[model samples]
Target chain A: MTADLFLQILVSGLLIGLIYALVAVGLTLIFGVMDIVNFAHGEFLMLGMYASFWGFALFGIDPILSMPVTAALLFGVGVLVYQVIIRRIINAPMLSQIFATFGLMILFRGLAQFFWKPDHRLVTHTLVGGNVTLGSIQFGLPQLTAAVGAVGVTAGLWYFLHRTRLGTALEATAIDREAATLMGINGQSMFALAWGIGAACAGIGGALIATFFPIFPEVGSNFILIAFVVVVLGGFGSIVGAFWAGIIVGVIEVVGGFVVGPEYKTAIVLSLLLLVLLVRPKGLMGKA
Target chain B: MTTIHLPKTVGALALLGFALLLPLVIQDPARQNFLILILMGAQLGVAWNIIGGYAGQVSLGHAVFYGIGAYTSTMLSLKLGLSPWLGMLAGGVVASAFSVAMGWPCFRLKGHYFAMATIAVAEIVQVLVTNSETLEGAVGLSLPMGNTGVAAMVFSTSKLPYYYIILGLLVVTVLASWAIERSHIGYYFRAIKDEPEAARALGVSLTRYKLVAIAVSSFFTAMGGSFYAQKEMFIDPGSVLATGVSIKIALIAILGGVGTLLGPVLGAGILITIEEYSRVLFGSTGSGTDMIIYALMIILVAVYSPAGVMGLLHELRRRIPSLRAKAEVRA
Candidate 1:
């Protein structure tokens, strides 16, 4: 491939990686704090895509403008799911947790199919229009905008976790749930918060993906697999690791796409995942 | 699961005899189709349970093994003039090898994490098959219409032979499960599933148990796929290796009771019947009603009785001693 083509792929991949990081951060955090793999993380993004679509279609709102609303709404959704369904299964066997999330994923997908009929929906970006050239290489302005938003959100989240009191408590809970409880920190509430935030992250990722990829009932399935790949490559439960790993994965996808066919990109990505696990099962940024 | 007492087992055998004779008794094509499907589902479920239930290692990519069985067997028979009987064994062995290769790296993962990884592998296989020119690209493969005879192990008009074959396969699967339950291998599988570290500490070889579980699972699953391919007289990467097929196997296994011998069959039978009824009676189009039923059954089964049908019954039987006595009396 030509240098321009390679550069173009790199830029696109970097942007996509940011979104992958954003989506997977929530999953990582959920695993970190709650010790549960929130398998339904992708459906939250699905909801975000649909929400953004309606925002554009019904009220003529831009996805950028609808982002905060989606985040807030999805936050509430995460909390609700945690309290109503997840909390009850918190202490149950591992099998219960896996099936519950799977059930939730199926239920949401069914609801969408029943309501929307599997038709794909696209929401046109009003503000972020056209493309820009950087040193003779062109990139879409919307993807750049999404990248900026993703980076901004990641920075903001990092700050929230590192700088705030609630964030420290969350970190404490994730580090040692029993110790955190002994210290008068409510681990349950902290877990709920992490899941809520993770849900919100999914919403952001969904809105960004919807800006480009059309929304469908199976869209969630697509991202969920990628999200799992990202989380696994990053670590089982590390948000910072997921952020960086997402970028690595994104770049790998671009490079791998050039090496293999586009259809085989996912397979190549997974093999890379296997490669990483083979060398280091705990992942790159796993805690020592 | 029903108790394994000899007379009770013989009585169950008599019931199975009467049930298999339904095709001869009724002879309606629709009834024949339902019975065949039930047998197919049961067989698939039993196949799936070997890994999912027995080892407690949920693999989401079993369809890869299944497709391997189907394609290998069918291709061998068509190209090499081999009997499907021999070719099916070819498929089973290939799938077993594939499962071992895939499971080795994957089984390093714990529980649901392993499940997700397997799903990724399955997706990769689907994509690979879809793009392969050797597999006829996306055009798919068609078997030269084999005549309805025991020699070809296929049928053009009659579904009767296929029904009996699948019944035989189901019986074999159950007998295999029973044998596994009593073997030292079964004890190792149970120990590894419940407490891997403890099992390892107690001198169980983790690798051997896992490989055995997955190999057996793949073999049975492969047989089911080969059977399916012959029945359809057509096969493809998309149809055989799709996510839906893998999930269906998992669903039926989960529905019937994963670890139990007869549960997989019972679950598969019920699920296939519901799907067939939806297609015929309810006139639900391709995938719509089937997917809905699948999702609902999974949710209800997971929520109400996570152990599935056999587990649910076992608990009921445990609670009501008289119920067991009555069942014994009925037997």
Candidate 2:
């Protein structure tokens, strides 16, 4: 490939990578706080996309304008899921925890199929429909805007975790739940909070991409595995790790697909996961 | 203890005798097919119990072994004209070898990490299989229907032979599980599951035992896959290699009771019945009602009864005698 083409592919990869990071940040946060991997997390992203699509179709609200609504809706969903299903299995065996989440994944997909009829819906004629040209590089405006939105939400989350008292309390719970409880941080509420934020992050990601991607019941399956790769590669429960790892995974997927065949893209990323598991099980940022 | 065991043994034998003769009495091909499916599910579940239940390893990518077995037997028969029975044995051996190779790196991880890695491995295998032209790719391979007999492992006329073959396979699977459960290896497996650190401190090699568990589990699971290939006379990544198939195998074990010899059999009967009935009722509309019901059942069971149907039976058994004694005392 020429220099210009390479740069274009690299830019495209970076843009999608930000969204992957956002989705994984939620998954990693839930894992960090409660030590439970939410398999239904991608469904939250799917819901966000649907939320955006409905917003546009019903009220003529552009997907970009309705992004916050999607996030808020997903936050409520996250909290509801925790209260109804996850709470009962808080102290259950690991196998039970896995199946609970796995069942939830299927439940969400089934419900979505029931409601949405399994059709793929797209938010066409959106505000960010055109392309932008930089001195030597050009890309779709929707991609650029989605990347920007992802960066904004991720930065806000990072700041909240570091600068605020509640965020610090949440972090404390993640680090040591018993100690956090001794310190008067209600572990249950903290778990609920982590799930809310985690799910909101995925919702934001979905809304961001809704302008470009198709909305479907099973769409979450495509991103869920990739999000897992990012989570594992970033070190479980590390936001900063997920951020960088997401970009790396995205670039590798796109560029690897470019080099090999498109069908081998998933295989290439998964091979990276295996290599990481063999060499560094804790991941790039997981604690020892 | 012998008093308690004698009746149980007699009951088991009586049940087996009934099962042996049921195929002859049940003449409908469709009903026979359902029985075959239940047996198949039970076989896979028992196979998974060794590693997932006894050894305390949650491998979500077991379809890789199933797929490997199916592909192996199909390829051998298609290319070299080998009998599927021999191919089935070959499939089991190949799957066992592959399990050891895959387990080498994967066994180092724990809990969710290990599970995620297994999914990744299975996904990669599926993708590779789907893209490989020599393996027939996504088009899949169909076995020759010209020759059909006991030797070919194909019965075109009726489902009776297939039913008996699967019944024999399930018996063998349960016997293998019973043998393992009665041996010192079973004790070591439980130790590894309940107390990994203690097992390691006591000179039990966790990796070695875990590998043994996976090797045996994968062998039988692959046999089931090969049987599926012969029964269907077609093999594809979508049918045998899908993650859904792996989950179903694990679910059967979980729903019945993991670690117990007969739990999977009970689970298979219930699960396959629900699956068939639901499909029959809602399959045409594609409304996903079956999936919704299935998902709800899984969630409820996982939440309320993690120990499964066998656990519930044990609970009932313990409670019933106490209730009877109280009633007698009152009288």
Candidate 3:
């Protein structure tokens, strides 16, 4: 391929990777703190997209302008799910826990279909609708904004976890639940916080991508597998690992699709996941 | 170890006798088709229970084996004009080989990780099947029209043959599971499920036993797939290899009570009946209603009774003094 085409592919991969990282960060965070893989996580992303879509289509508000509203809405949903269903199964068997989340996945998807119908919808004439030309390369403005939003959200999360006391307490609970409980940290609150933050991350990702991608109830399925691959490839519970792994997966998916065939793009990403899992289950940055 | 309780054995045999006579009594083609579906569900559930229930590995990607079985038999029949019976056996072997490759690497991870890995593997298989030209990709393959015969595993008019065939398959799977439950392998499987570390320390080769379980499980699942292909007269990646199919298989086992000899059979009967009825009542417009009901049932079962329908029966047996007395007498 020519240098310009290569650069275009590389940049596009990087942008898509950022969104994947954002979605995966939420999944990894929940897994890190509570050791529960949220199978309904993709539903949260779907909800976010719908939130943005409705905001744009019904109220004449741009998706970018309504990103916070979508995030807050998802944050409440995360907490509600924890309170209603997840809290009861916190100590249940592994199989039960899995089915519980899987059940939630079905419930949410079904609810979406019930309420909104199964037709695909998209946000048109959004604020970030045009393409930008930089020298020899051109890129969509929505993608660039979404990429920047991902970086900002990720940085803010990192700062919150590392610099703030509340975040430290949450991290401490993740490290040792009993010790954190002994230290007078409310474990329940921390768990709820993790869910809130996790859902918000996915919501932000959904809102950002709503500008460019089609929105549907089953849209979550399209990205959920890729997000899981990212979470595993980055290590089970490492944020930074998820970030870099997301980029790697994105690049592999796009470049592999270009080189081999687009139909096998998903296969390429999943194969990378299997390889990493077989060779290094702990992932690149995950603590052994 | 092969000893069977008299009452339970007699009860199961009576149930089997009833099932055998069902197709003859039920003349309506639609009702016969429903029974066939229930039998198929039972067979698939029993197959999954071998690994997911007995070995305690929650595989969400079992559709890989199912799809493999379907694709193998369909290709063999379409390409070489082979009998589906032989193709079915070939499908089972192919699926078992794939299972070994998958289970070896995936068995290392526990719980959700194992489940996630299985999903990825299934997705990979689906993608590969969808892309391959020989498999006809997304357009899929249809078996050529030919003379109906027992050897071809094709029947044109009556649904009775298909019902009996699947019923026979279900019986074989249940008997195999029952035999395993009473054998030394059963103890080893339970040990691994209860405590993997403890089982390993006691000289149980975790990988070997788990692989054996998954191999058996995948083989039967693939056989079911082959049966499904011949019965439907068509095979497609979307139909046979979808993640939804895998989830339904797991749900049937879970809902019936995993690891029990007859749990999957019972679970399959209840779930398939409910699913088919819901589809009939709502038609295509009520697209997500059946799923909502299934989801609610799964959540309720997981939260309230992880042991499923069998667990409820056990609880009932415990609650009633007369029932407890009869149970003690049987024991």
Top-TM-score structure, candidate number:
2
Error of 1 at B223 (Å): 0.7
Better of 1 and 3 by DockQ: 3
Q: What DockQ does model 3 achieve?
A: 0.70
Better of 2 and 3 by DockQ: 2
Evaluated on the second chain alone, the candidates' TM-scores are 0.92, 0.97, 0.95
For candidate 2, give fnat to 2 decimals.
0.69
Instruction: For model 1, report DockQ.
Output: 0.44
Candidate 3 pairs with clashing backbones? none
Sort every candidate by lDDT, greatest first.
Answer: 2, 3, 1
Clashing pairs in 2: none
Lowest-lDDT window of 10 residues in candidate 3 chain A?
A: A279-288
Which of 1 and 2 is the better model by lDDT? 2
- Writing each residue's lDDT as its tens digit, candidate 1 over A1-288 gives 788887888887898888888888888889878778877888898988888888989999988889999989899999998987788787766766777787778767767777777788887666777789999688877778778877877787888888999999998998889999999999889988987998999898777767777888778877777777788788877777888888988888877887776788888888877676666777877663
Q: Worst lDDT window (10 residues) for model 1 chain B?
A: B282-291
